[model samples]
Target: TMYELVGKEMTDKWTPPWPFGKKPTILQLDELGMTDVPQAERVNDAIDDAKVETAVLQDILPDVGFGFGSGRAVGSNNWVIGGNTTKSGMPLLANDPHLGIQMPSIWYVVGLHCKPIDGSPPFDVTGFALSSSPGVIIGHNSHIAWGVTNVNPDVFDLYRIKVNPANPLQYEWNGAWRDIKVRQETINFGDGQSPVTIQVRETHLGPIINDNKVDKETGEIQGFNNKDPMALHWTALESGTILKAVTGLNEATNWEEFREALKYWDVPSQNFVYADVKGNVGYQTPGRIPIRAKHHSGLLPVPGWTNEFEWQGFIPFDKLPTVFNPKRGYVATANQAVVPLEYYDMLASELGEGENYAISQEWDYGYRGQRIIELLEKLAPHSIETLQVLQGDNKLISAEELIPYLGRLRFNEPELNEARDWLMKWDYQFDMDSPQAALYAEFWMQLANNLFGDQLPEQIKLEGWAREMWAAYLLMEQPNDTWWDDASTSDVVETRDDILVRSFREGYNNAVATLGNDRSRWRWGNLHTSTFVSNPLGRSGVSFIEKMVNRGPYPTSGCTGTVNNTRWTVHSGSFAVDHLPSMRMIVDLGDLTRSVAIHTTGQSGHPYSKHYDDMIELWRNIKYHPMLWTRAQVEAAAANKLILKPAN
Candidate 1:
């Protein structure tokens, strides 16, 4: 596990042997605002202490929600390579950050040109920029192009704090009682409605997310009787100047300047891929990388009263996983376990391994990264078009790996037998028109649940795409495991074949009942179509208002871990796409004008504008448009131009 390796490295107390010596800067315990209790441990204890069944515990769990700036779980993919590896003798960079499909879209194309000052040359930067954010998030200057993918580092910790028995407003931390800060917030709905006021409290650890208070008679507070208060401690609270780093990125002309800009970037850590016109390429994982103490897994909540679990310090910036001009020719990242194994071993060797620590344990199941690497290895002298093709590639490796196993199953039922034969004869690509894709998806989902649904507790039962992925691994590698058996059935142990046949029959019957009996008409796109609508307005009482304003119901290919990831979710009663790549960009350093990009929706947010949904069909067809680097190109492509003038 990534955490195990990181823990081993930390226990060893090995530091990166960079040229610069270790600095004295360390985060104070108070600065971290950590509570003395571990959140997970506290929550687990509460769940165990509950008298009700585990299934009902879901309702008891606090409904923690994501804020506007929260980072997504493992999905984005980015890559960059040296010019020597490309056809045009220029570096190639591609990025398709996976974000939720939204109506105004998440990005806007922007070009900035600063006039020359002093002896410095004028700078030209262009690419995608977020709505209110100051600079281009993933873009290119005249000298270099760069992109980003999420780097899953464990930067957030939850601490459980012991409430002072004498005073409800105090918490024990570091052997002392500290009064929690309290604030009253009143939310007004206006329109003559009364305001609702709530009291918010903060412990030394952070904000008290859920205070552990149990009603004596009911033995429940809100829902389950929580044992202790838990406060969230995240590195983002003290993140460095991200805006400054982004602004610098727009002007950075070389690898050195680019890297220098990244020094100020410290929140929502990313895998930064770099490619310069100078023919150099590099990869860096940057953020406030936490250095956990010995014996701490960084998983469960730890006691806040002791300093042992506090972060020693951030990993040295230079020490964070980095590679410059590797012999592999290209660098790719897809939110996978990116820190090399050798780095962990080196750290373990340096520091004696008696303690435990962790960097991160969450990573995407490297299907996208694996597929991209395979294509890169085969395609030397690659072009921007080559990359564009690779970006749109919908080869379902997950299905490919498991389809053969499903085909070998001999089913007793006619529908099950027919479905197995159909899967065996079909190609594994998750193209929109493939009926086989739909069948395979359903089979995978059903078989997964059948195999392991009973094995797991109701609270943690695997479901959706995650379940399918896990089932693929288990069926392929550990088919003989007792997990395949249905625990409810007595005196009958289900074998892999027994489970496979039963799951197929069940899935086939469900598919027929829902989608009808015409196998030829069972198109994956019919059910898996992507949508982009103004969610708020669409749900409004005014029906015709938003219906005329939305875009999509467009056919798309791919599944959760594929290159073109268009995922389906349970909406209403049926499946609909809830996630997909929001944009795609391919930069060719040899010629800036030749670079191309396309977002899911068009440039404008206005519903009636010609540009609003113009790109929908193009995007659905898996196409790209000229990025328009030069002023002339942008002007030529402009439908309506606006010139701002200074007013006297």
Candidate 2:
């Protein structure tokens, strides 16, 4: 049906043809011994069919893994304000990396200081580091302070492999049979269980992540029936000098050295924000982003038998996005698109390209970035106190964008009209104590479901926040669009206004039912809460163990896309916060001693330790502890110290 709707060229060249016609399936081709068909064409056909099937299955099947919570709102918020915009007359840098809420938090705060030795640069850094990682992931050295947010680059691709029918160990490459390299990996259990081993097949492209297709009922891997196995080509898999880059960053003095250090950062690309004692602010995007073929969009799997869709090497480090002391006096990134369209044009012109210079299509919705910019511009001459307050902002731009539509809708019921009036007079903040926030949250969720739930598949349905915001905004101009009509109701054609009124009434009723008839008692915090859960123990299923290991379902503010991002899943039909700012940090180059930071949980990993959950209240309340930088300050704040000795 989709194939007929889209027509032949669009389906054949771009999207896969849906509801596959009489075209021979992958298994059928192998069984019938269709060697006359070109391997490249055969593989492409198989890939198309597989893509269509996967799409269909994803639509109908219940979501696997974390279900609705699987798409935990991603991306971090980081910004740097130059001396001109700060009260201290020196740059100020703020960062809050958004991540899943957990105990023994993702970050381990530490201050590493090493005096210059053996003609090496002095190393003095303070900030957050991954518990398992070596150097400071985001922090400030003596001369400069830096923060990082994910760049969200498209640095990986899937290549559909065409296996040789004669020998399963071989695959087609440029019309010739190439041996598929097999690596044996054994998993040894700690409890003395039998070691299980499996063969990992690899092509020149990369490892075959999706190997032979298996029958769901029989649980048998049908070897020959698997016509096209996909091999993954990811930048992270390639050997990189990320460790070298980390060490370099820890010791780097100025913008020049900072830029030089980032050259070695090859994987997990990041937008590095810089602020130094020299009153400078800068931004740099560094990583090995692949330059793809002109025809390939990198959105779907391509034929591995041919070199047409192969990557044409990486974008040069020097050519990557960078800004030094911008005219705006500030730099910020929230996993949004880094470069402008003009940047791509310039890159193409300079590179003399028949290749696509487009870095990635998968960037954030830019809501956080926009908010950060808005604050930075509106509230200039910022100080440590002001910046700290800014980090706690819970205003939702999505609400601001969509709430106006509700004002125009006329409700029939008196209660519905009263609820609409109350919502209309409210500020768009997801404050913990706000009753209007609670009502609006429920209304927003209901509106999203009413609009797209019946039309789109379960997996692809809009689940409120950014996706729904964008959809509603676009559809607002087209009142008579087919999507506005309720698919479930055939007798009555509902317009956008009709759906809005219906959703409002339903949302009001639902909120009243959940929070009671008294509207004033409906506080956002009652439903929207945060739980700092411990791994293994918290999920052990025993009530006592869970209560002992997990922190409170604490009242919290903010929603998805807010600066104070405490994310909850609407698809789960629960308002409990699933993700939040993993760690918050503010660095004042004007006064490093004044800098402060805090993570979701405390420093200690031990569940029984008092330090385990000490910082929870402070983090939730947007409060912070001083980031001790100087030796004197560190010594003053030290509660206990341990000494190391060499075993003679």
- Where's the lowest-lDDT run of ten residues in candidate 1? 17-26
Q: Where in model 1 is the C-alpha error above 4 Å? A: 1-74, 117-123, 186-195, 212-227, 348-357, 461-463, 466-468, 487-492, 569-574
Q: What is the per-residue lDDT of model 2 for residues 79-101, given as tens digits with 9 covering 90 to 100?
A: 89988888878899999888878
lDDT of 1 by residue, 1-648 (tens): 212333333212111111011111011112223223223332222212221222322433332111111122326778887777888787899998877777867788888887889977676889998877877888898888889877666676667777787776787777888888887768697457777665667765576666434568986445211366666667765636889888888888887888888888787778889988878888777777776665565655677755667777777676566767766677887666564323443344444343322445444556677688778877777998788778888777667677777767776677677767877888777888888887876776677677756655544435445324634554556566566678789899887778877877877877787678999888878767887878577545676876876766777787776778776542123456666777889998888889898888888888888888888777767798888888889888887778889996
lDDT at 631 for candidate 2? 92
| Ten contiguous residues with the weakest lDDT in model 2 | 18-27
Candidate 1 at 369: error in angstroms?
0.9
Listed in order, each prediction's TM-score against the native is: 0.84, 0.88
Which segments of model 2 are wrong by more than 4 Å? 1-72, 187-196, 212-215, 218-225, 459-462
Question: Candidate 1, residue 131: CA error in Å?
Answer: 1.1
Best by TM-score: 2
Clashing pairs in 2: none
